[model samples]
Target chain A: MNLLQKFCTRINLTKSSKGYNVSVIALLIILLLIGIFLSISIGSSKISLADIVSAIRLKDQGSNNYRIISFVRIPRTIAAVLVGCALAVSGAILQSVLNNSLASPNVIGVNSGAGLFFILTAAFFPVNIYLSTIAAFIGAILAVFLVYFIARKTGASRMAIVLSGVAVSSFIGAITDTVLTLKPDTMIARAAFLIGGFSGITMDKLSFAGVFILIALIASLVLSYDMNVLALGDESAKSLGLNISRIRFSSLILAAILAGSAISFAGHIGFVGLIVPHVARFIVGHDNRLVIPVSALMGSIFTLLCDLLARVLFAPYEIPVGIIMSFLGGPFFIYLLVKGRRGQLYD
Target chain B: MIKLEDISSGYNKITIIKDINISFNQGTITSIIGKNGCGKTTLLRTASNLLKPFSGKISVADKPITDYSDKELARKVSFLPQLRSVPNITVYNLVMHGRYPYLGFSRTPQKHDKEIVDRAIEEMNLASYVNKNIQELSGGQRQKVYIAMVLAQNSDIIFLDEPTTYLDINHQLEILQIVKRLKQMGKTIIMVLHDLSNALSYSDNICLMEKGQIAIYDSPEGVYKSGKIEEIFNVCSQQLAVADGTKQYVFYIE
Candidate 1:
């Protein structure tokens, strides 16, 4: 048994040290599965579990339900999971590396940076999602460097980093706004950036973002041990022979890729990245390996459920999933800040 | 043994300490004493490869410090920087981090690593609070947890910067006594200390700093006999042999 397992064993007395409380993870997965099953079945057109079963079994070759399930609901559901996993895992990485609870792609200007560049790409190259995503990747990287450039100049105070983020975010927002006002024909890009939704997802876009999110997720899992060292603070970790700069740089890149792609597909989804990692830390107790994976699972599950609620709340008149997430995530984030004083829901 | 060959170190192209030359003896407790900002901490940091020297070179056991990778350097030396954050983690988890050099990603601490952490915690007398979050501990207790982490590292040499700063009198004594015990266990110990009395009583050697230079480097008695200690510190010091055979230096502002 590993040392962390022994540490975990104190809390979970019935389980052996070799297993570090995967029961919670198992429960989250089950919840996600149930949410997925419900999302596919009880949408605008109610297809029963039997229809879903027969469709999966391939027995019902001529069913309309099969066509809707295969093309529409499945792609939409997959998009929600991918975006959630991306944002949450990325947020977890940022919080640890930056040593600040409030560090997320949205809060740190990465999403806004991605959004700005994406609009520029859409303006220049119409309806080209591939160019827009590539533009997002570049912009996200540039934005992180801008934040770092600001922080490095002033010796990187925690409050100073946040202030730098605010500056960069505002700058990115103003530029995006100016671009939109100058050229109104770029409303297609505006539609994607302004109202974050998953209304009409195609297999191609899903696969495009899915590959990046999957690779980013795996990369984060591999670097999870380094993230744990970082929580002890840079000087101490450096003393332990960790190259703090290299670790910090690479982790930020991974987080950017995750957030940039999420924003590339869905319009500035605010709170998933900020909130999920905090929830995961509360559940798994600050081991980033556990926290990273838990955050990904929990994020996917929560977004899937929220997306479900967004669609079904008022039949035929659907609100954006981003709206539901903001409603849920904003209040909870504020609560975390208040409870942060009381030593809860924060690392 | 660690040797510093006229090393100069600082941040952002600015040299804080210039042209420092010293070689540390093996199995000795060497306490560096100086005025605030005299570069004692900087020297300690640079010697341990935490800060790159602007000039000169440092070698540990005949190998240039730059030759070692981070993990290899970690195996040879452990450093406890000034305490700031109380990392929102338990004592057990914190100590387990000391095994970083040995374990990579996805490898959990085995029985061997667990025993090392347990022994280090026991040595620091923090076994009772092993499960407690670091923030929940007292200042001295938290400091001990950090020390426990370095002890678990099991390196040949250890560097501690102001290890007893911001501690109560009793806690200071307890921490210094622990350092003496560590020296007895045959680990090379180098530390930046503000307490001259503790340095005089507990350490085998003292390096006194003045204006970012090593003004005096000698045994406690030798440095005391040089008459520079009084001028540098601006205090009159008297020696008193206590209940133990070791003599204590008491300083009073003149």
Candidate 2:
């Protein structure tokens, strides 16, 4: 009887601790560090942890392991972490602002929007990295605005945003297909860009989007409290002195910047944005104050692990990280939908 | 004190309440009572400044509502609408949000804000449910939690749209008792009520509406004596003296 009581107490402790923000964040941060370490060390040519430490310490510019770490592994690992953080936080903001669990950067046409514009910039412009990032950001903002205006104009219902997003996504997809078919040689690495991998990611390519993601992440954190109030519905938020339109607009813009910058380098990486926020909410409940940071951290861990799997799963030949994400995320999302049928997923 | 002069407003371009002129005295409980589609809610919403009037001016505490910033107006007046989302939140967290107007940009609740929330929770008999998710609460309990949140706002003027709607008999009386307590604390309380007897017996004044205008705004007794309530509601009313020496009103269709 005493052992049963102890076992029940253990279960209760785990349940309650999952809802605590600090502990969850700490655990995720630890997991993220481990993920980063594993991603850097466990490549085709295995570099040990001690070698990684010595590589950083010795600053050996000539050694092969040092060259691999500095040129390839470091940039790839950082790209995965930043992309994860960006998409996850973007999805978190979209979910709260739209008040729909299904809303995500990829689902709502944000990632595809960025992808189309990046491809357009590459085709039309001189393939400037900065210009492509800006174009992608512009596309993301436009897509979100289009989705929002349609949803609002039609009397914003819970499902209206998602429905309009689907419509807009398919329309954009058609345009993208036309562009690709017509200008077949416009983008040389078309499949890699569409499928989203970090194979040729360099420090230069990651630089612009890296800064964009960091700034937007900080802005989301600063406005997280207002986001919490905004989740209380427009009338209540206004009654509590929140400028409803301003907060909502700001959240949308922030989400756009995050998603756009991420897609600029990572291509149309799907499901990380969609799934990470849900996982974060499941851990921390619904406060954006905790949800934003938790989502950002968990996103980095998830993407890092996925990217590592993409690298080592087939050894020598690599698959796009997006494929692995869809493989895992598609089933998980269906499970969420099925479980939510009784109103368990959302409340 | 809140005064609305020549206020005309509605959704989009269509006006629901037109040329409404009314005033709510400080430290008094005023109930706006009317049938469906009679613009009682429109008037309450307009007076609270939730619905921006298309034409006229609304003044709270002798200053134009537009003159005050959103937070400043929130500090002076708090409005609770008929429909509210049941967000997945805890009782404590929901009540703490009432301090939004007073919070700095960081929005971290200070010691004073927590104390205010605690007092409001205690007043609503929600001290025991502070950590519980609001979704787990019953309807009456949820209503009390919302009222507790409003109480935590600590505003001078409070607007409630049908505060007693969907509540049972005992909870209805309980909410009214809390309203009375709020009035006694020197807060101006304005609400829309569907229960004629409760409105008539509890409110200091009753603003009766017909169509899109105020039929009469007078003391409860004066409005009752004027026979406008009976004529407008299409019901017969009798004033009976209760055992406690207070008056009770019963309404029935003749």
Q: Which ten residues in a row have the lowest lDDT in candidate 1 chain A?
A: A12-21
Q: Determine the C-alpha RMSD for candidate 1 after optimal superposition of all C-alphas.
A: 3.6
Deviating ranges (above 4 Å) for candidate 2? A1-19, A126-131, A145-171, A186-190, A332-344
Q: Per-residue lDDT of A1-347 in model 2, one digit per residue for the tens?
A: 13422554575644334434455677788999999999999989999887788787867678999988988999999999999999999999989988987788865678668778877887788457667767877787788788778877865544677788888888887888888888887556456567777888899889888998999999999999999888888788889899877887688779888988888877878888888888777656788988899899988988998899998999898988988888877887677666543333565
Docking verdict class for candidate 2: high
lDDT of each: 0.84, 0.85
Give per-model CA RMSD: 3.6, 3.1
Candidate 1, superposed: residue stretches over 4 Å from native = A1-20, A58-61, A145-164, A332-341
Per-residue lDDT over B137-239 for candidate 2, one digit per residue giving the tens place of the 0 to 100 score: 9888998998898998999999999998898999999989999999998999999999999999999999998888889999999999999988888899999
Q: Of the candidates shown, which would achieve the greatest DockQ relative to the real structure?
A: 2
DockQ of each: 0.70, 0.82
Q: Taking candidate 2, what TM-score does its chain B reach relative to the real chain B?
A: 0.98
Estimated TM-score for each candidate? 0.93, 0.93
Score residue B162 of candidate 2 by CA lDDT. Answer: 92
